[model samples]
Target: MCEEQTVSLVDVLEEDEELEEEASAVLGGSDSDSCSYPQGYVKRQALYACNTCTPQGGEAAGVCLACSYKCHEGHDLYELYTKRNFRCDCGNRKFSGLQCKLYHEKDAVNSQNKYNHNFFGVYCTCRRPYPDPDDQVEDEMIQCVVCEDWLHGRHLGRVVPDCVELQEMICESCMNKNPFLWTYAAHLAGPEVLVEERRDESCANVPKKAEVDDVIEPSCKRSREEVEPSCRLKVLQASQQKRDQSGAVFWPSAWRSKLCSCITCQAQLSAAGLSFLLDELDTVLAYENKGKSSEQVHQGHDPLMSALDNLNRVQQLEIIHGYNDMKTELKDFLQTFAAEGKVVTSEDIRHFFEQQSRKRRRVDAGPFYCS
Candidate 1:
């Protein structure tokens, strides 16, 4: 019984080694053959295998996907699955989807999960078949994402891979036919002409007429040299309207008309309009009645307040002028601040004068009052 058991164990070991050898032979073990294609590939392709291990009779049957030589005739290509020698006839080192069942767990819910299976596709890494993937898989074909159609990878360059959870089984040809679906940003039509037309029309009312001849010539002029006064008014009115519509037009000459259309520009113009109102507030706040017993602060409000309250064109101009004056004053204030290392506020100026008055009072003993 002991002798018989030993012989059976030896036979089992021999069978295992034979199986391992067959597995290696199924994968293209030869380093000389390989294939490559740049565009990318997809297919029910023959996996990478070792050319050295492939049998002579197998060469004529189902050709290597990498080299197009049928090395396995009667047997299915996927039967040669194994741990160390997992590869295809094309010399692809990675397992194809057909053989994926043996080594990879199929994730029905999420195929993209790399942990599950390499459902994304196979990559060629065959050392024996140096450029085998190129030689095995046809260059013209690709697995379409939309439809599972095998198409020339070159022709489907226009198609963008959809960002879908499931692989796009449909080919590029089917995608082109669908009205709802189209190509990516690169394939979209040219500049939107309608949008451009709308923008042009927005500033269409702003009249910027060409300059007419300034000098009046005599001696039977061939044509009348007078321009319409109304036309000039229209131009001025347009300029003002454009300014009002867009805000201050200060930019590249081409952009000036469009500048007023921006919301920020409108807000800026509105803020500038408040300058005249602030000026009126200042006049009211100023101290009046310098030297007389009868002198009193003006109880009645300034008439300019009423004008400022109403947002008329004249008020806007006043506001603009005031804004310019304030800008100049601000520049002077900034210079003073830089030199002093502190901002000189209105309260600071008033307090300074108050201190001067206190010094004068301390020095004078007699009743010294200035009217």
Candidate 2:
């Protein structure tokens, strides 16, 4: 977001000649020279009329630079430039609904507030415009995927780790508006998982080439380009289309604006065991985890245990039973040693494993059992 700046009529009059030429070209043989400021008023500069202020059918209306400053101060005014040589219609009968308050056309408007990001000269946390005339810094600016507004890297407060062309960046404002978007951004920004390596003495016996491969190779790797794509844009567009078709008034405008079906958001929802439909009228209804049971389970269980419980139920049962069986045998063994007044050292445990291997070789039938 940027603070509104007061624009002086003198500054508006001195707009570059190139802009005027472009506007003249756009008008194409329309008598550009014929249009001038009202009689006895010196024509200082040419300017494009505010499309919003122009009567619905008269969108092509143009205004002089002074008239634009006087009448359409807060309006979204387009710059047509000097070549178009247009006069102000702000005081004309066509715009009788809106009266010009500035008597001296050269003076500045009191409150030149701008509502949309399009009118902003600068944006983001830094609040500096692109190609800042005063500052010669040449850093690249990134456009927010959601707002489609440009922002500086420093303002975003993070280095863009991936190639921008391949991935879209959602602004912080957008993320704050939606929990799903926040999760998606956090997931993207989180540190990557690294493969663990065994540095035990036994690993020394492994072949040098194989050992090198084991150390360098990651358990899983994904390229930055692969991670970020136009999928989010496509999902947003589809969601918007669906909303337009539904014509449902139940959905809040704010929620509708934040609606997204990006892969990251979908994956996050899936990880949380949530199922949802994009076109559903009620987002709360589409979400599967809304029930009190899920909420209770989430809040009551330890996070670690809850995560483990998410594994296959059969595997979970096997792990519990296996641990119990191992515990029983270990207790029995310890009791036997206590009765004999003998302490079981580390060597004894190593020997027992060696003996078990030898027994396995001799039997050559059933699986080896250590007792």
Candidate 3:
């Protein structure tokens, strides 16, 4: 009996090892079965957000790699992860607000290319996107408050007394157009001015007649030169605050006007309008997809399409879906499992799917149905 038990245990161990190998094969298999891209079609680069261009409703959107180099060169760009199996949408009627400068036969340009900045990557007095180390100037480059372009210290000239004192510096062109920008000073003297006012208040109790005379005519008057700096500083501070709040770093220019009408902006505006209409028109008739052909409409739409539309409408109404809840739960489970640093096996995936299926079945079954 003891020998038989030992042989059975060995056989059970061998079966377990085989099952483990099979599970590994199922979970860590090659993805050759996945869809393949066409030959000669090069993979597109990652998406990038153009800080220079503003989308409709003031939200920012990502542009294609070509758009970033061609149109948004020298403009602030934030890179996003590469999206697989997608074409470049820069200069398209949905992503870019301006025409494509580098648009060619290879580019996917449409009616969206309305206005182009004709950006050639040359900017500032140095005429380069970045400072050339060959020049060997130690002065730091400052961004122009108006044009939003980085200007070398030499280009700004004597306008900026010291680069250290520069918080927000306006370009020469902007200052030339609006001379008032030149007079902006720092508002650091506010505390000092308040201290002087407090000192004046201490002398208010001296004599009634003296106090009245002091109120009518100040003991000391600040000269135009002394007061101008403080006034300019206050103005500058106010302007900076306003700009920061509005998220507008660039100076207002004609380029902005052209950008506002770009394809990206038009698409955004259309989407927003449609969303507004959908919300306003909550009737069943308005819920139908307008893009459907007469035959498709007559044939009765796919249940999946109707379900998705209903889900969107319900979400708009602030109603949560069970599927979304299930997704969140699954996401949390996967995250937690990954965090534990354990190798997830096919068993884990199968178990998760089984649990979700059971839950779905329970939901599909009426509440009155028993075990």
Candidate 4:
């Protein structure tokens, strides 16, 4: 029965399953077969922009996963990954020539959705595409917790700290716009390493908890009305305080929890347009977890693994070699279609393997002469 070749076969399949899981993590839990327009403004979902229709410098637009396939199958797309509080805009006024196939009804615009240069296929301070083919150096794009825009590490204007996945980042632009965040960064930002030996010395201006409470509540327990004005006055004074932030701030894991929850701070948060920062569900990690949980494990995916048990070793090796060869060749064969932004149809895939079979036959028939 199948043995050594069978081991190779199992190894190949295991690798494929891992790749499928990783892809699922990116796609989240969005229904790929259904248009998301009917769902109204989604809190977060994988979205894409079609370069064939919404070109660079044009009105930026986003479509749901189903529309990416049904309406813009052959178009080059900018994978926007995921955006929050967005509704599907497929076949909206921005697109000149495409119509929604999955759900034909759509409004003329999705005005609530946000846009950045990334919708046009550029990223980072360098303004390069995600996989900039012309660049030699390799880099990873890191998303800012504030703007939610992706940036390269080198252009962050600060040295990226280690264990970045364990940290939340506020890009310099966000920090500068709200200088008050620097006060929190100095006093409350965590994971410990980012805090200096002299944190207390540097953040001396920030009021300690008991001091703040004493200022708000006075000598003893007080009614809500009696304490409210004092709390507001103390925090407004605290809000005016700023800490020196020389660069982008890296916050410790679950740093959002460190934010003050007192009534006055809540009012301050609402006033500064930062209430979303308090919502743990708004993080990218939460969104990806939703997608991962939704991924249905297809049953019978490993049925071939069971069937391999009955095959002779010779047949097993033949199957293994064929699978390995086809995987490599098929990938090489598909690159052209991807580069051309063309959708590969079932017929095209069949034709490619047929040509591969003919080429194999020609090679098997060759005669090695004096050379």
What's each prediction's TM-score? 0.15, 0.26, 0.26, 0.64
Model 2 CA lDDT for position 130: 48
- TM-score sort, best first: 4, 2, 3, 1
**CA-only RMSD, every prediction:** 37.4, 34.4, 21.2, 12.3
Tens-digit lDDT track of model 3 for 105-158: 334332221111112233466676444546666766665533444566556543
Indicate the worst ten consecutive residues by lDDT in candidate 1: 243-252
Per-model CA lDDT versus the true structure? 0.30, 0.43, 0.40, 0.72
Clashing pairs in 3: 97-262, 146-251, 185-232, 185-233
The whole-model C-alpha lDDT of candidate 2 against the native structure comes to 0.43
Off by over 4 Å in 2: 1-115, 186-371
Better of 2 and 4 by TM-score: 4
Expressed as tens digits, the lDDT of each residue in 1-371 for candidate 1 is 45322223334446877775443343323221333221123122223233233333232111233433333233323221111111222322222322221123322222111110111122111212222356665443333322222344323332222221111223333434532122210111111112113332222222222211111112114546654332222233233221111101111112112112235434543454312211221111111111111121222355655566778888778776765665676556445655555544556546655765675567556676799
Alpha carbon deviation, residue 371, candidate 1 (Å): 99
- Counting clashing residue pairs in each candidate, in order, gives 49, 0, 4, 1
- The numbered model that scores best in lDDT is 4
Q: Per-residue lDDT for 68-164 in model 2, tens only?
A: 6656778866554222112355545545466655332422221211123322344455766446787676666765533444677545544443333
Better of 3 and 4 by lDDT: 4
lDDT of 1 at 47: 38
Off by over 4 Å in 3: 1-118, 121-144, 150-179, 188-321, 334-371
The candidate that achieves the highest TM-score relative to the unseen native structure = 4
